[model samples]
Target: MDVIVIETPQLGDRSYLVHDGVVALVIDPQRDTDRVEAAALEAGVTITHVAETHLHNDYVTGGYDLAQAHGAEYLVNAADPVSFEREPVTDGQIVQIGAFRVTVVATPGHTHTHVSYIVSDGTTEAVFSGGSLLYGSVGRTDLVAAIDTVGLTHDQYASVRKLVHEAQHDAALFPTHGFGSFCSSGPATGAGSSTIGEQITTNHALTDADEEHFVATLIANLTAYPSYYAHMAPANMQGPGPADLEVPESLDAAELTRRLADGEWVVDLRNRVAFSSGHLQGAVSFEYGNGSNFTTYLGWVLPWDEKLTLVGTHADVEDAIRDLSRIGIDSPDAAIGTEPRALAPDAPVASYPRVGWAELARDHAAGDVLLDARRTDEFADGHLIGAVNVPLHEILSRMDEIPAGTIWVHCGSGYRAGVAASLLQRAGRDVVHVDASFADVESAGMPMAEKAV
Candidate 1:
């Protein structure tokens, strides 16, 4: 059997297509089913089974729709209260598709009903540990509910041990999350590939035999996840339809200006440097590129169900749509161009000054507000003495809380700070983008804050 991996790097997740040269089984598919369908076609295999480890808390699942489209059996946990029909799978249940045998194992941690699958060809075995056993860490246990977090943490510990005991030491380990996904308890080890044997000695859950320490460490390390995650589970339970990848209607200069005037979200998809140099007066920067996390940040900050207008080139707009579609945002209005000036010829553009850590330290001002756009934990670790900690995701809701002044926003690497700076600038605050790495703060001669004893 051959395993094909379909990676969604934007969301830090993977979907797999496992085949026995004739029939295939797909696991944890994203809303876009076309990619999986294309993979099956290229491999000359018919999809006969599709399985979901659990109701996801990050993106809408395409399992229900994909099964219907291809006339495949949809396998979902028996305990999940989903609205669609599915082949109810339980712990220890074995299924056969062509020459491959699949075993379902209960591994509740990421969610109450989460499970993992072990697929074998009688000679070689591969384990699909969706959000359970990750590269180094395990999936976060708090997404289900705050009340169940402690219990789920313990469950996660047992689940990881269970997986290690059940799967062969040399079995190929494939996880749906932990590739830079927030679902991971902490930073993933960034391993491209691993096996059960490799993870045995390296994975934190395995190396740290103390269950209480493991649980406490995971809970303490859990930072703020995307606000958009709140909607994913409900949408998945109701059964999401196929993703609508159609390009949104194009907006002319007048329409773009009107939308801006009306205070709609007109996201400018350019690099941070270009965005800070020039953009539409009301357009906020959400740069689109590889490893940008464009969808995650945008989805987290923007109000749900609001009219969104994307401004960028055709390629950027198309790519943004696909990324947003994975998170259930579809049919957004679009304005294609190299910059805001070209998109809105008749309109006046806005620009902000970009500075570095050294410059900020050199031009010391008493009244200026230093806004730290990193997460809360990051700020607590160490930051500039007086920098206000307003994470990029919370910039919108907590706008009024930021002290009024010439706001100099900075993040760990300035990517998030760029987004925060544009939003502040659009909100009529005198903003400057500190486009420098936070690592240089001390070397640049900036004063560091001390932690509370």
Candidate 2:
């Protein structure tokens, strides 16, 4: 038997496949179908079962179309009393294929209908845990009406116990979401798989903490769900077809400028400090605590729902497009992939940073001005002693205050710094978007000023 996991970084989601001999089952597919279809063909198998762990809030699921093409049956936890065209898999139901016997466990803390599947292939095995369990944490219990406060908290506790208690000793665990996930608990893990004993032994959520403390800690650390979540839930619940897959090309610098000047808001997904120094004049930043942070936020932040002309330091654009497409905003023509075009003075001037951190420090000490592009709270905590603070989102109106020098800019981390560097470099400014740890020169060890108490 073979199990494949597809991680979609764009929308903070993942998909799973369980195969035995020529038969297979896929769970929580991404909007793009090509990735999964290609996986099946390469594995030398025929897909026959599509199972959704739950209604997703991050991106649309392509389970339906995949099931249709392969003449497979699609399954969801029908015990929730919800309606669906495919067969409803209930708690304790076992799905047998070749040497694999997948037993459905009703693990519903994240949602009323959510279930975790334990796949035993008669060997050291794994569980198709969906959102029920993950590395260092668990799923968020806040997805639409399916979430009942007391019920969910209680259910989540029970679910955690069931997964830990009822699971086979040797079964490894896999979840649909992980860190940076809008619906996942976090230590921001990037782990692909772990054993049930591993989670119980190491996962903070499954540790010695009592149920009450567990629930309390979960609620406190949880960030609010993204705006696009509402849309994604229905699309997945209805079993939307596979995403029309495509690898989008990113736009070159000049074309990116043209698109922005024409009204598209560049999203600087990079971390803080780096963003502080400089970025496209009007790019929307996700380095702060406004909840939604992934490229999926592009749907909520983009002006008038215009097609994007994306620019990022990473050469891979497929994840970005997949992230965008998950919330129902797919466009193969969205980006212009890197080939550097020229932008005029009137063009919108967002840029990605090309300078390294060490060089930034040297420029800063050489009398180059350092700027801090972070939220008011982060800037107020501690920044480079002489650096200026201008949050990325407010750059347009505050552009007037920017000093005319060889500016060395920074954000909390480096992503924003890169964007700022890109824009400034394109504008012919001798600006170094500093990706190092910089401060707005408050006292040491402070957070955003206003957010402090």
Highest TM-score: give the candidate number. Answer: 1
Clashing pairs in 1: none
The clash count of every prediction, one per candidate, is: 0, 38
| All models, RMSD in angstroms | 1.2, 6.6
TM-score against native, each model: 0.98, 0.72
User: Per-residue lDDT for 258-347 in model 2, tens only?
Assistant: 656665555554444434444456554444222334464445433335565544444334556565666777663434322222323444
- For residues 192-280, write the lDDT of model 1, one tens digit per residue: 89999998998988888899998899898999999999999999998889887877778888999899888989998989899899888
How far off is residue 355 in model 2, in Å? Answer: 9.2
lDDT (C-alpha, whole model) for all candidates? 0.91, 0.65
The reply for model 2, stretches above 4 Å from the true place, is 79-84, 145-150, 246-262, 265-300, 310-323, 332-410, 417-434, 438-453
